[model samples]
Target: MTDSNVSFLGRISLAVGTFFSILGDGEFAARVQRLRSGAPVTQAPVAAPAPTPAPQPAAPALKQASPDAALQLLGLLQRDARFIDFVEEDVAGYSDADIGAAARVVHGGCRTVLREHFTIRPVREEAEGSRVTLPEGFDATAVRLTGNVVGKAPFTGSLSHRGWRVDDVRLPKLAASHDASVIAAAEVEL
Candidate 1:
């Protein structure tokens, strides 16, 4: 709190106390970094409200989702991947080898459907397992914090997964009369 010179022991004590503080408080960590780099230290330990953040648009609003798109997606999945069939099937008696083979086919079809209909990409550019730092005000929805997510942002950790983001969707337009509820029509062979 004071600019008065601290003794060697006192500096160590400060380091130990502030190390915990830095972990819990991003602003404190930033100030510590500034001091370490010979920048002027503010007397107040409490971080002043950042004015720029005051105008930060509120966390993106959760839009009122239409079920039509969801149903359409399901229909596409059923058509391409037989996803519904795979999920609904009673595979309890199937051997692991058989299930694996079936899964391989399903996986390929599902992948194909996703690739065709959606322009998908990883949320982060960095490779998984790479060290990354999430700056303050990072979109919470985009970068889901996992495993011991404590304290303020400016989080530094290994990238567990480069999470997917749907850049674009290209679902086919359906007729107004078409019933989206029927994901897959029952077959009636003549």
Candidate 2:
């Protein structure tokens, strides 16, 4: 995903608002970038046909985080008051026709967030996917995020694999209203 430098809260807010707009429009879906980086292999060359130069160690790879996961990360950030307020302001000043348009605009602002949050890009590409080499003692899990192209539902579905492996991270709860169908149904006795 292209780095937007937009904050996490802004992405969450935009995701929710965009969902509503798509529901209203019925012809738009959020665009997301799915990224993977390759890891470099370290090896020295062996002389065979003639005198061959030893292979030099390549720079560590930097992997791009999945855009949907990034949005989910934003959702997590929304839990904080300061972040919530920042997102609110970022979302409030927009005068677009719907959240879809607004989200596209905000998407452009997340460039820095993408870079900083992940903190590393794969220096090389591996066959399986991208590989990011962390510091000597860095320990982290991979976060797998699958984005559903269902109009504008804010990258619906599960987040797992590494990092914040949260399950069922949907936008309904985070959406502006709690009086939704599910909420209303849950209020009644089964």
Candidate 3:
């Protein structure tokens, strides 16, 4: 073969080798090698076909929370703490002092609502900024590790946040006459 033809053939051989390596199929690689070396490729003896797998039963559907129930809770928050008002307010026109004062009011109201209605507890007992070691088979839902997470646990990391969990919710029952969609009534002065 000419030098150019040999170079082209070498390129083709390298491409095929790379492709086979990526595929990681030993039988196909062996067959290709036998073909390239001008050796007669023999097929291995075929085993009898296995029986088909039985059909599996479908999983049960998950129950979803009512949208109105969520809306009622939001309405309750708006009524008790004026949470929607504070959040929806445009703070750009206000001074830092004014904003801070408003925030303090909002914080106090929200805290009162939470304390009265919900039983909240920290997910992690350890204090924030403390060093922690997560053993193997750790609960991924409760504790989320961030930054440079590699390999299987026993992962050593510092606690950045002490997450909260609502153990009990005791939201007040909404009246039949009350419309949950109406977060707050329009105000008017006589």
**Cα lDDT for residue 19, candidate 2:** 66
- Across 3-86, the per-residue lDDT of candidate 1 in tens digits comes to 597765577688899877887566777788889988888764565664333223357768898888899988888888888888
Against the reference, the lDDT scores of all candidates come to: 0.81, 0.40, 0.75
Better of 1 and 2 by lDDT: 1
Q: Which sections of candidate 1 miss by over 4 Å?
A: 1-62
Residue-pair clashes per candidate, as listed? 0, 29, 0
Off by over 4 Å in 3: 1-63
In candidate 2, what are the lDDT values of residues 1-190, reduced to their tens digit?
3467757666778889876665533223322211112322232234344333323235569898645444445544443222333445645555656655645445544544444344544322333343433332222134222322222212323322233322333332344542222311223566
Best by lDDT, which number? Answer: 1
Evaluated against the true structure, the overall lDDT of model 2 is 0.40
TM-scores, each model vs. reference: 0.66, 0.20, 0.62
Model 2: how far is 69 from its true place, Å? 19
The residue-by-residue lDDT of candidate 3 on 60-103, one tens digit each, is: 58898778767866776777778888877767799999989988
